[model samples]
Target chain A: MQHTISVLVKNEAGALSRMTNLFSARGYNIESLTVSTTLDTKYARATIVVTHCDDSVIEQILKQLHKLIPVIKVCDLTPENSTTLELVFIKVDSKNEVGELLKIAEAFGVKVIDVSPKTYTLQAVCNEKQLKSLVELLRPIGIKDIVRSGAVSINVKSE
Target chain B: MTNKIITKELTGSQVFLECLKNEGVDTIFGYPGGVILGIYEAFYHEKKIKHYLVRHEQAAIHAAEGYARVTGKCGVAIVTSGPGATNTITGIANAYLDGHPLVVFTGQVSASLIGNDAFQEADIVGITRSCSKHNYLVKDIKDLARVIKEAFYIANTGKKGPVVIDLAKNVLDAKIEFEYPKEVDLEGYNPTYKGNPKQISKALQLLCNAKRPAIISGGGVLSSEASEELTELAKLLNVPVATTLMGIGTYPMNDQMALGMLGMHGNYWANYAISNCDVLFSIGTRFNDRITGPSKEFAKNAQIIHIDIDPCSISKNVTANIPIVGDAKIVLQAMLEEFKAKNYEINKENKREWFEQIEEWKKQRVIPEIQSEKLHVHTVLEQIYEYTKEYEPIVATEVGQHQMWTAQAFNFTKPRKLLTSGGLGTMGFGFPAAMGACLADKNRLVLNIAGDGSIQMNIQELATCVEYNLPVKVMIMNNGYLGMVRQWQEKLFDRHYSETKISGPDFVKVAEAYGAKGIRIKKKEEIIPALKEAIEYQGPVFLDFIVEPFEMVYPWVLAGTPIDKVILSRKE
Candidate 1:
């Protein structure tokens, strides 16, 4: 099972290390983690995606995270109850399928952010499913490079 | 516009002592080094806080832990950087796991030199983060006083544990206007001390409905000063009471409802009650594997109601039907209030049946017997218990079989009387902790019951005890092996022994060299007189009792087995 946990921490040196230590120290598998300063510059929010964990373990990890002095809040986000987004940049060899790739990007409402003689770089920001589909659709076009911003979420019920 | 501003100036080291005073700290256990020289200089000028210079930084922390455990007050320790800071790691981990309140101040390299790997410098904050309840590395001089205040507050409140504050050398040298924060507002650290009304009601309902109820009180009860409440509740509800090793003194051992201890090497009756109970009321215990045996099988027939101060500990191991996150004393009081409000009373006849069953289990329980004419370990503990029974002495122990023997044989009738490494089970905790206990109260006798292997772990602390003139009587059960590990190897590993076989310097000679009284007893007949002599005239006395080398703690439950599946005797 996978869980997307949102953590709010004080903006300080080693704050991220303290939060990540809670996972690494316990051998919890963290699939993706994205951290950025919140609107309040004094605080930062980190969205951590963990895989291959059970409900009990996830619950404990949340509790341990709460114990960290730098951490202010921890929210376990679910797909139904929370809004989430992941942004990805995909570069495909467009010499062979320039028309096909552009058409596919237009269909998904993605922009061709960059284009070279042999490749086209497309940018998309959406839910994980739509992002995965875009990557799958472009695989036949020969992906030259792909980079993703890890999942970030906010609970619908709380600020 | 003539406006005059007043500023008070003081060095960071002076602020350190001032903040400690504000926290009501009267004593500190610490060792001085190059990086901590500034604090030592400030200490010389400020004589308000008495400092006990321990021989080793580790002993300083253990002594502080002992002091904290005895007084229910936060213990304070100070050590210099690098090796000095790392030396306290075991003691910090022990206190952290056992929920002892300790605040440790470690000197660090100047801020500029921290990352340069400067001489005698180590990242104390980074090193201690995982072991500490909370830690701070004070970079700015202005944050020094507030961080110290927060360290003490966090260390002593809620689910108490050790907190480390790493002070850079430059910060100690820098002068700042010191204003101690009256209160700390940590957004993430608010702890709920009161039980939820609904949860209390539910727990009370379970208690009223239970036909076979058992209360397992743990270290939380001791730490929270809830023994009276726990005892009253158990008696009021006609529930049999058992204690974890850490909870030894939480209830009177002589009480009819009391079952001495529960878990691996716990009393047979207590283990039986746990396995058969209709409702298991656990207070202040983490349900560690040693107590639960096999987590899945533990109290499978019972509804377990776990009340802990730390929310994370509630269901980390075993699931709790009713999880109450609150201080043990507060929660127990709430439950008692709810019971009275609802006019709930125990059905005497129904409870009588349960008591009778526990009695039956007690009758069938195996009490280890000394089959040899030679002196045995239990006999030594029994004699010590008999000698010290009148004084109600504070007992501390190093980890191993002697610790278990002391737990089994010694009578701890009140809370905070017994101090041992219950969680981390760190070796060499007993002697220094006993010194700390003695330091806290000079009137009461302090005893350190140690194994040959464990006593040697921090034997250097004997000098500290002698220097402080603390009357800590150390009784070493000379088993010549790490008795607990050897017992396991004997049972499961074909008795290969391996590195379990260990030797120690003659403790009597060692004590004499440290300018402490020394006594050696090789026969059972000499035990009582030696104990009396040592207890009567002792700055510090190290008594070596050479007992049976192969004695094992019985009623042993193998790892991952149910608590009920205890091996009754060696033959069994």
Candidate 2:
């Protein structure tokens, strides 16, 4: 199981290390993690995708996070209960299939950000499932480079 | 008194001292270095605060923890940057896990040298973030006073734990208008001291209905000073009380309702009761794995009511049917009051039947009486207890078999009488902690009951104790091995000891070198005289008791097993 967790913490030095240390020390797995300053630069919102933890373990992990002084808040955003988006940029070798690459990008609502005779850099903003599909479709053409923004999440209700 | 407002200017160092004084701190455990020179210089002119210079940074923090445990006040420790700050990590983590109220001040490199990795610079705040309950890095000189005040406030209040304040070298020298905050408001840290009324009602109802009710009191009961209420409540309901290692002094050992200790190395009768009880009312304990073996099988027949200050602790390891998140003192007091209001009293006749059943279980296995040629560890501990029983000594211990034996042998009737590293099980905590306890109250007898392996861990603290003239009796039970690990090897590993065998320096010479009295007893007959001589001495006394090498803690419970399935004797 995977859970998208949004943690708000004080923007202090080593806050990220402290959060990540808790996960590693407790043996929880972090699939992907992304952090950025919230509205107030004094605080940061860390969007982390934790995998292989059941609901109870996830709850316990969140409780442990709450014990840390720097952590202000922890929220678990399940797929059905929240909205999430991930931005990914994939550079595919488009030596001869430039037209096919553009068609695939258009179908997935992706933009062809950059292009050269040898490669096509495509960017896509989508949910986790759609992002996986886009990567699978581009793999045959050959993926030269790929980078993901992880996932930023918010609950449907203001909780 | 007239209302007069006088404004004064002071350096951050001066403000730091003033804030501690305002908090009624009379002593500090510390070490001096380059980054902390300003604070040290300020201390040179001070008369109100006494500073005990420790050998190592870790000892300073452990000493503070010992002081805090005895006095029920936040202990303060100060050390310098980089290595000095890093050395306190183990001690800080020990205090954090065991819930000690400690405030540690680590001198940081100047604000300019912070990120540049200049001489003696370390990200101390970053290093200690995971262990400390809360930490602060003072960037502005003006925030120093407020930070110090808040550090003390947070360290001592609401389920106390260690807090760290990283003082930049420049901030200590900077001049600032200082005004300490009278109060702190942290939105994220509002602890519920009062238990929910509805939950309390439901818990009482369950207890009244339960035919086989038992209580497992933990360290929280001691921390909150709720032992009196706990005792009263146990008596009123006729519920037998079993304590954890940390809960040694939370209930009087003389009480009939007392089932000494429970879990691994716990009493057979106590573990039996916990396993068979229908209603398990746990107070102030986290239900650690050691206490609740095989979480699923633990208290299988019981409906549990857990009362604790930390909400996360409830249903953490074991499920709690009724969870009341509140301070043990406040919550216990509320429960007692509610019990009184309801006037639902236990009939003595019915309670006697329950006691009779527990007594029948207790007689099932008798503690083996060994008539061995070598001095037994239990005999040595029993003599120490017998000699010091009248004095009502405050006992602190290093982690191992001796720790468990001391917990079983010593009789503690009140809270704060015994301090040990329970959660973290740090080996070197006893001696320095006893130094702290002695320093906290010179009149009371403080004993550091240790093992040969553990005493050597913080052996350097002997100098500090001798220098301060703190009469902390260090009783070392020398068994020539790491007894606990050896026990496990003998049981589960087919007796392949593998590095468990250990030796130590001549403790008598070591004590003499540190300018303290030393006594050695090889024969069982020498135990009483040696203990008496150590007690009568005016300074720190290090007593070495050479005991049987293979003596193990009995009634052991292996991990992942049922609590009731305990190995009663050496033969299994």
Candidate 3:
């Protein structure tokens, strides 16, 4: 099972490394992680994606995150109770992707962020399923490069 | 000028000592170096604080850990930057894993030269980031007082672990107001002290309803000083009580209800009880892999109700049916109250069948027998226990076969009597810890049971002990090998001893070279006399007891094996 956990931590030096070091120290898996300063400036939010974890392991990860001194809060965010978004960018051969790629991008609700002579970059910010399917559609067009912002989330109940 | 706030200005070093004094700390275990000279200079006029300079930076922290274990006070250690700071990492990790309260200070390069890699500078805060409960890098003189206060508070409170404070050299020379923080206010830190009343009641209900309930205690109970509460609860309920190595001496091993310890290398009956009991009520133990052989197979028939101070530890290894996050002492008190409300009584008939079953398993329990005419580790431990039991001595152990033998053979009736590194299993911890233990309480006897392979790790501490006049008695079981590793290779690796065989300097000569008493005992008849002389000696003494080289710790359960599935079938 894959679980997404968000940790709110005090904005300080080595705060993110604490999270990474903790995962490594406890032998916990981290598939993807994205960290950035929050709007509050004093705090930062880290979204960590862990795979092949049981419910008990996820519970421990959350509890251990809370144990970090700089951590203000930690929550396990599931797709059902939270709104998640991952911004992905995929670049492909512009000449070959000029016509059908735009059509496929339109169908998948992705934006053509850059269209240069050599490459065209497609962008999408959606939940995991939509992002995966969109990336698959672009793969046949000969992808040149790819980048993902991992996953960010907001608890719906909090709103 | 009318709205101005004024405070007395003092140098950074003055504030440093003042903060420790304000925190009620009078002793410092540390060493001096170029980067830490400012703080060392302040010690010249320091009347309240006494500093014990150790031979190595690592020994300083271990000594502090030993001090903390005995006194229930946060251990304080200070060391210089770079190599000096790096040396203490092992001790810091040991304290972190064992949950000892230690506040370690490491001097760093000037704040401006922090990332520039200046001479003798290391990012110790980042180095100890994961191992320490919390850490701080004092970039400004103004933040010094509050950081020190918070370091002390964080180390001593909640789960009780090490905290590191990396100080820049320039900051120590800078001027700051000498007002120590009156209180620590960490926004992200608040520990749960009182257990939920509903959860306590529910757990008590489960205990009352179960016919075969047992209590497994761990270091958290020792940390919380909840032995009295745990004793009462176990006695009143007439439930069998087993302890983890960290919880040894918390519940008297000789108690009829006491099943000794339960885990790898634990009591056979105790492990059997843990395997078969229906209601497993664990207090203060984290259920680490050492205690629970295979998480899935451990206590398969039991519904575990775990009470721990750290929430992260509750279900980290094994799932807890009822998890209560609070101080052990507080939760035990609440459980006691809940037990009273439920009119709990000692109804022996209800658990008569369970008791009979445990007794049956107890019949298979293994004891250390005099296998050969050669001196045995158990015999030495038993004789030492007999001689030292009257003083209520504190026993520290270097990790090896001797450590396990001491853990199983010695009977400790009080919490904090045994100070071995349970989680980290550190080898060199025993001697320095014994030194720290003696300094913590000068009157009580302090003993370090060591192995030939382990005693050499921190043998340099003999100088520190002799200089300070700390009468720390070190009994090295001279087995001529790393007994634990040798046992593993002998059993699992086709009787291939490999590199487990090791030789060391003559410990008695080494002790005497460091100006401490040294005694060598080769015959069984000399054990009593040597121990008496060492105990009577006014300074540090090292007793090298030559013992059988092939003895192994029994009742050992292989990792991932069921606790009841004892391999090797000792003395069958």
Candidate 4:
């Protein structure tokens, strides 16, 4: 199972390493992670997508994170309770299939960021599922390079 | 008086001592070196805090641990950077796992020279990150006081552990206006001291309903000073109390309900009760691999109620049917009140069968009593215990066969009476820990039961003991081999000793060279007299007893085996 955890941590020196050390020490897999300053300068938010952990492991992960002195808050985000987005840039080789690539990009609501004779770099902002589908559709056309901004999450209130 | 206003300027070194004074620290275990010269300079004229200079950087921390355990105050130590800082890692890791509170200051290279690989520089904070509760590198003079304050608070609070403060050379030399903070507000760390009322009520319900009840107390019982509460609860419920290695002395071993200790080397009846009990309520013990033979099989017939201060420890190794996350002292007190308020009757008849079963297990296959004429460590330990029992002496032990023998042989009757490295199993920890224990209380007879092999690790500390006249008796069990490893090799590794066999310098000569008395008991008849002489003598004494080489710790529970499936003797 996978869990996207958002951690608000104290913005202090060695805080980032301390937060990451917990995952490394436990041999937990960090599938993807993004860290940035929160609104308050004294703290920072880390959005991490972890793999291969169950409910018990998640509970342990949260508790362990809370144990670290620099960590301020930990939130285990599920798709239902939170809004998440991942930005991925896919550079296709084109291979004389420019029309097909553009069609595929448009269907996923992706933008044609760059174009060249040899490649077309398309940027997609969507959930993990749509990103996976977009990559699968472009794989046959040939992906020259790919880069992704891991999950960025925010909690949503229930009405 | 209150901490005065921050108007007076003080050197960083002065600020350091003042902060310690504010925290009620009067003693420090430390070693002076190149990087820590500034602090030493400040100490030259200081009279309030006395520093005990240990021979090795390692002993300094270990001694602090000894001091901390007996006194229940966070131990303090200071060491120079690079090798000095690195040497304390073992002690730091040892305290971290055993749940002892310590505040260790490591002198670092100047702030400008950091990462440039300056002389005597080491990235101690990064090195000790995993091993310590939390660590700090003070780059600025202003953060020094608060860092020290936070270090003490963090070390002494929650689960209680060692916190390292890597004091940069410049930070120590720089000037600042010192004002120690009265409170530390850490956002991430808030230990649950008061358990959830509903969960605790449910636990009480389980206790009230349990006919075959047993309690497994861990080091937390002593850490939270809840032995009184634990003892009361056990008496009220007519429950037997089995303790983990670190939990020894938390419950008096002589008590009828006391199960001594439960683990791989635990007593037979205790492990049997763990396997068969209907309700196994445990307090303050992390169910480490040693405590649980096979997690799935452990307490299989029981509904377990676990009380722990660390939330992560609950359901970590074994699932808890009712988990109350809180300090053992407070939670157990609450449970006692709830039980009393409800007026739950002690069902003595329902528990009669359980007690009878335990008694049968105890009589069936007791810990083996060898009738051999050859000198055994057990005999020497028994004599020492017999002599010191009336005094309520403190016993510390280094890891290995002797440590287990001490655990088996002694009847510890109070909390913090048995101080050993239970969690990390670090060898060479006992002797220095004894020095600290002695320093903490001059009234108690502090003894370090050591192995011939393990004592050599920090033998240089004899000089420190001699200089301070700490009167720490080091009783070495000389087996001419690392007995525990030899026992395992004989059984599991096909009689190959490997590197287990060892011999060293004459301990009598070593003691004489360090200006301490030394006695050797080579024959079986000499054990009692030598113990009497060592205990009665004034200064430090090293009593070396040559014991049988092949003796093993019985009631050996193999990994993945059920707790009840223990080998009673060597042949089994």
Candidate 5:
């Protein structure tokens, strides 16, 4: 099972490295991680989406995270009526592949954001699985560049 | 919101010293280095706190552990950055494993060059996080006082362990307002204090109904200073008491109700009693794998009741029928009160036969064999005990057969007199620990009994004793091998001694090189004379006794084997 956990932590140097090291040390597979500064100057929020772990194992990982000095709060937003998003940017061949890419992007509710002489940039805001499939489809059509903002999640209601 | 009287500006070192004074620290063990020069300068003029310059940072930490173990007080240690900090890792881990209260301070590179990999810049906090109960990397001068206070409080409180405070060099030099925090406001640091009343009542009821009840006390009781309450409860219930290695000093070893240590290398009688008891109450011990050998068959006839300060330890190793999470002192007091309320009667018939059986086992199995002219480990231990019997000296030992022999032969009638690295089984813990123990109670004699192999691990501590003019008598049982490991191989591995053979420089010469009195005892009759001469010396003394090899610690219960199947002695 996959778990998407959101953590609020103090913005300090080596904080990210410590979290990543913890996951590596425990042999936990982190499929996706996205971190950003919150509106508060003192705090940074990290949304981590991990896969192939049981609920109990995830709970123990969360408990260990809670023990970290900088971590203030941790919440598992999965199975809790939450909203999740993943943004992906891809540049495809505009000369010949633009029409086919646009058709596929339209099918997946993606938007064409930018165009160049030889390439076109496609923007996608969708679930992780959909984003992955869309990227795979655009890869064979001459993908010049690709960037992905790993999954971010929030619960439907207040904590 | 309120005006306050401004104090004079002070250097970081002065502020650090003031914080320690405010925390009521009387002594600290440390070695000065380039990074910690500021702290050293402050120490030169500090009159309130006495600082002992240990030979090595590693020894400093172990000495601190020794102080904590004997006094139930928070021991403090200071070391410089990089190598000095790294040297203290083993001692820190040992204290953490043994749950000793210790506060360690390490100097760091200047704040400006912290991340630039400057000279002597090791991330002490990052390296020690897993080993310490808590740790802090102080970057700002203003946070020093609160961090120091919190470090002491955390290290000395519930399930006590070592805490490290890594101070940046620039922070030590920066000026700041000094104000110690009266109380900590940590959100996730609450430790459970009161055991569940319902569980306590249930445990009491179980004890009331048990026909053969026993209490297995561990170091937790000693850490909590609950020995008095534990003895009262045991006597009120007429229960037999057994101690783990760490709990040796918690109860009077000579008490008839005491079954001695119980574990892989424990007394046969104690192991048998634990295996045969109807109800077993374990307090302040995490049932280590060595103690519960083959958990499936451990205490097969008993219902276990485990009481520990940490809730996670309850079911981590052995499953407990009744688990009580609280401070050992508080829980034991409540149990004593409940026992008083119930007016519990002693199960005289059950205890009578059990005690008789233990005595029988002791007479047949506990006695060591006198084979030939060669001096045995037990004989050496007996000689030491005989010599120190009148003075009631403090005995600290390194791990192995020598330690067990001392524990078995020496009659410790009082608490805090027998100090050893029990939980950590740390080698080289004896010499420095003995030194620290002597510092704590200077009026009494301090004896360090150690195996030759174990002694070599931290033998450098002899310099510390010599420097301080501490008269610590060290007896090294020299068998030219790792005696304990060889014994195990002989018993369990078809007598295949692989890497047990040990060869090294003359220990006496090594002691002499370190400017300490040295003596060697080869003849059987020279043991007492050598010990007396060494004891009479005004400074630290080392006695190396080249005892017989292949002399195994007997009445040994082979690992995974039952207590009843113990091998008493060699047939030859």
Candidate 6:
């Protein structure tokens, strides 16, 4: 099962590498990772979305993470009933299929964030599956560029 | 009187020097670089502190580890940021895994340009976080003195491991009031120092009752410098002693009851003893997979009594019937007293017969028969052992068949003398670690028995040895293949050799290239003479012995197999 993990770590050098090493060493695939400074100046919050691992494996990973001196805590945000979204910006050729692209964008509730003479940048805020479908549909019309922000998640209820 | 005032503007380099001196650090190993020029300027004038310019930052870290391992003191290293810091990653990890105390200082870009992607600003603290027990980033100049003191204390205390302090260029330049904190207040860093007396008494009772009892010692005993206590306990209990690869030198290898190494590549007698014993007492060792074979089948009939310094390591791998968590030195000392108080007598019912059986097994399987004209790995170990028989020199080795051979062949009667990277199994650990060990004990001869692949990993340390004029003998078992991996492939993969064969430059030439005396020996008769010549050489000397590639160390127990089910050489 795919699970979203939130890790609170000391804000220090090589922290990211350490996290990546932990995952890679155990043969765990990191589907997406987002890091930012937390409310505390001395700590950083990392939200990592991983896939196809059982609850026991996820618990093992968290236990291993706790073993690291810098890691303060690790939380599985999936169980907390949280809000999550993945951001993607894709540019497509708009000269020939402007109406068709606009219709598809309206159907998915995506916004045209940027526009050039021959390109239209569509911005979408959705889950990973929806993002994948959007990319697949736009591939027929020719996608000039695609940039994904992976995934960022937060719990709806405060701790 | 009111107008009298003094002013001095000191750079970060001056602060670094003052901070080190304040922390009572006597020596440091580092190499100067473009980013570390300011620190070098301060180092130039610091006559009170001795600094050795190592060939590489990695060697510098290992050198520190050597100094720390022997003296039980904090080893210190200084390096420039970016690649310089990154180069020491493996050494740091090795020390971290082995639980050695080390303090590393790296030069970072000035505070203003830290995130600007400036030259030599590679986020060293971030790079070393996973490898280090703890790390600090000196953002303010005022924090330098306190941070340096804390780094040393933290690295040397509790569960000892490497700790890094990344100093910003500006922090080294900015001057502030200097004061060193005498104590550290860490809530999460408490190490267990006292073993439970009840548990110790129970373990002693078990030892007294079992006719066939064995003590399996590991590297933790060496780290705690408790070999004396361990030896005393084993003798009092009248039990045979076996060691893991990491625990090589804990008990005198020549001792009558000593069964060299126990595990996959361990001695047959040791494996037999472990399988037949009624009680197994493990001390200062983490029963690694290589040592235990199949966890479920290992010592199935024996009751396990585990004693360790780290609580987390007590039952982390193998379940212990009696878990005593504390410092090895303290626990062993306590056990000795308890044994004396109880006046325990050795059980003699089956003890004599068991010992005789073990000795027979050793006579039959421990002694290797090398019939080939080519120099075998066992032959090299025997030659080295013969040469160093009187001295019992500190022998360090890299990860390979050579490492196993050294562990089995060499009689390490003294604890903390056989220094090798066991938990990490680092390839390039020998040369540099030997250099460190030699530096730690100037009177003792340090021998680095390394494989061709493992030697090339840290061959650059020869320059450091030459610079220090340290006499460290480098014996290379040139099998021209990744011996261990190849052995596994040959036995398990039906001899389908993929990328195990090593095709590279000659090791003798490579050793000479590093400004060290080198000798190449192809004849079997020349092994002793070459070893003697290398040992006699004043400075560092490398002897490359071209060994047979397919010769596998025997009495092997495949992973997950019981010790009794070992596949002997004749079976192969």
> Which residue pairs collide, candidate 3?
none
Sorted by DockQ (best first), the order is 4, 3, 1, 2, 5, 6
Q: What is the lDDT of residue B334 in candidate 4?
A: 91
- Residues B1-572, model 6: lDDT tens digits: 67755546567678778767777778788987766788998887889888887888888888788777767788889999888988889889989888899999888888888888998779777777667888888889877777777788778765688999988877866776555567765533456788999999999888888977888988888778888898888887788899888777778887887888888888778888898889999998777888887777788889999988765566666778999988889989998887777777767765887777777887757446565778888877887899887776888888888888887788777766777787788888877778778767888888889898998887777778887887888888888899999988988899988899986577777767877888999887888788778878888888888888888877688877877766668345
Better of 2 and 3 by lDDT: 3
The models' CA-based lDDT, in order, is: 0.90, 0.89, 0.90, 0.90, 0.84, 0.82
All candidates: TM-score? 0.98, 0.95, 0.96, 0.98, 0.86, 0.79
Once superposed on the true structure, which residue ranges of model 4 sit more than 4 Å away at CA? B1-7, B365-373
Best-fitting candidate, scored by DockQ: 4
- Which pairs clash in the backbone of model 4? none
Tens-digit lDDT string for candidate 1 (B1-572): 65767678999899899999999999899999999899999999877899999989999999999999999999999999999999999999999999999999999999998899899988888888788898888878999988888888889889999999998999999998888898887877888899999988888889888999999999999989999999999888888899999999999998988999989989888999999999999999999899999899999999989999888998899999999999999999988888877877567787778888898899866667676676798888888898889999999999989888789898789988998998999998988899889978779999999989998899988888888799899988887888999999999999989999998888888999999999999988899899889988858999988878778798788898999998888888
Q: Please give, for residues B1-572, the per-residue lDDT of candidate 5 as tens digits.
A: 65987788888899999988888788899988888899999999989999999988989998988888778788899999999999999899989888999999999998888879888889888898777777888888988888888888889887899999999988888987777788876654667788898899889878767877778999888888888998888887778898888888688888888888878777777888788888999999998866787777778888889999876567656778999989999999988877677666655675677667777766655556666677888888887888888999989999998988887788776667888877678888888888888888888899999888988888888888888888889899998999999988886789899999988679889889999999999888998889889988898988999898878786677777665566667762
Candidates 1 and 4, the one with greater DockQ: 4
- Candidate 3 lDDT, B1-572, residue by residue in tens: 58778777889989999999999998899999988899999998899999999999999999999999999999999999999999999999999999999999999998988889888888788888878898999989999999999999999999999999999988899997688778887888999999998889878888877899999999999999999999999887788999999999889898989999888898888998999999999998888899898889999999899999899888888888999999999999988887887776556788999999988888875656566778999888889999889998999999988998899888888899898999999999999999899989989999999999888899899889888899999999998999999888877798899998899888888887899989999888999999999988898999999899887788888767888887435454
User: In model 6, where do residues sit more than 4 Å from their true spots?
Assistant: A1-159, B1-11, B22-24, B342-346, B350-357, B366-371, B507-514
Model 6's lDDT to the true fold?
0.82
The C-alpha interface RMSD of every prediction is: 1.1, 2.0, 1.0, 1.1, 3.5, 3.8
How would the docking of model 5 be graded? incorrect
Hey, what RMSD does candidate 4 come out at? 2.2
Q: Where does model 2 exceed 4 Å of error?
A: B1-8, B343-353, B369-371
**Which CAPRI quality tier does the interface of model 1 achieve?**
medium
lDDT of 1: 0.90
Docking class of 2: acceptable
Give the clashing pairs for model 6: A13-B125, A13-B126, A14-B126, A14-B127, B11-B173, B12-B172, B12-B173, B252-B413
Q: How many angstroms is residue B449 displaced in model 5 relative to the true structure, after the best TM-score fit?
A: 1.0
Q: State in Å the error of residue B22, model 5.
A: 1.2
> Per-candidate TM-score, first chain only?
0.95, 0.94, 0.94, 0.95, 0.87, 0.88
Off by over 4 Å in 1: A157-159, B1-8
